[model samples]
Target: METDAPGEPGPTAERDATIEIDVLVVPDCPNRQLAEERLRQALDETGLRAARLTTRTVTDGTTAARTGFTGSPTILINGRDPFAEPGAVPSLTCRMYRTQDGLDGAPAAARIREALRAAAAAGGGA
Candidate 1:
């Protein structure tokens, strides 16, 4: 693992090997759990279990804005918000995820898998 500080060097190599994941959500959204399951399934499908998985609850618009939390189930790899696009609108309401079949609350498991793999290849993001 690498660290910004000159001598910190981050966690041990083994400890740092795990992929960092963030599942950002809001309290009222009904898809939070489904999002978690989907992410886990994606990780399993991609054989990325060594990576770490985490979840965060967005309490207010301020936090959402600060984190650019699109809505419930916004996944972040490392410190970057992979689900967020350059010109996407920021809001507190529930968000819709685009899937092959149609729009849905939960992102497709395969899409999550692809995002995870891309994030890993990108060296865990900024």
Candidate 2:
């Protein structure tokens, strides 16, 4: 990884890497928009403009299970749920994120930014 200030361009190697981010939410989930906004912010802050983002609406339990839908507003980076805890079961309920301030409906920008960086370091967030 190359060293560059926030909002600046990173190394060509990172730019060439492919990153896929998915925001999965159930119908009537209140935090969906907020989560998407925070995710976009994280991507921008981490200088990952090349990332592809997808928003999915999981409406059924079976679909949730097959898609790894842990909860509404769940974020998956490269098909891996970075925020998922071990032994977490798939559900259609609204998810709570552990933010720096406290537990909230969505993950904090800082947390998402860190996750993005960690994924990049791991070679294209795979």
Candidate 3:
């Protein structure tokens, strides 16, 4: 991890200290690509290149429940469901997120990116 400047925690200090993120998706949904793209953009914007971003497909409700898998395109930051709210269930069904516009199966790119940055700043790691 490289530092963007002196005196600041090297990129490694923050990005390496924590901030592992992943996209939990179902194979049936094609929106996973969008999620990945959004994640990549977030990483770039937040300087989390070594964050080890990846993806996992939720194949069963049991795994979903364990992982708090709400549906395809579930973005997990440090193994925690950032998208999971109070009433969300671990279902194999598709997940939806509330955006400024309306409800959608995936979260907005900017929203996800900001969350990623915050998680990184907080040293949130898996």
Best by TM-score: 2
Q: What lDDT tens digits, residue by residue, belong to model 1 across residues 23-45?
A: 88887679888888888888777
- What overall lDDT goes with each candidate model? 0.74, 0.84, 0.76
Instruction: Judge candidate 3 at residue 106 and give its lDDT.
Output: 78
Best by lDDT: 2
Q: Give the Cα error of residue 56 in candidate 2, in Å.
A: 0.4
Instruction: Tell me how candidate 3 scores on lDDT.
Output: 0.76
Error of 1 at 47 (Å): 1.3
The segments of candidate 3 whose C-alpha lies over 4 angstroms from its true place after superposition are 5-14
Candidate 2 has an lDDT of: 0.84
- Winner of 1 and 3 under TM-score: 3
How much is 107 displaced in model 3, in angstroms?
A: 1.2
lDDT, candidate 2, residue 98?
84
Deviation in Å, model 3, residue 88 alpha carbon? 1.0
| Residue-by-residue lDDT tens digits, candidate 2, 2-119 | 5667777657445425678989999979999999999989887887867889998999999899878888899998888888878889999988988778889888998888888878
> How are the candidates ranked when ordered by TM-score, highest leading?
2, 3, 1
Error of 2 at 34 (Å): 0.8
Give the lowest summed-lDDT range of ten residues in model 3.
1-10
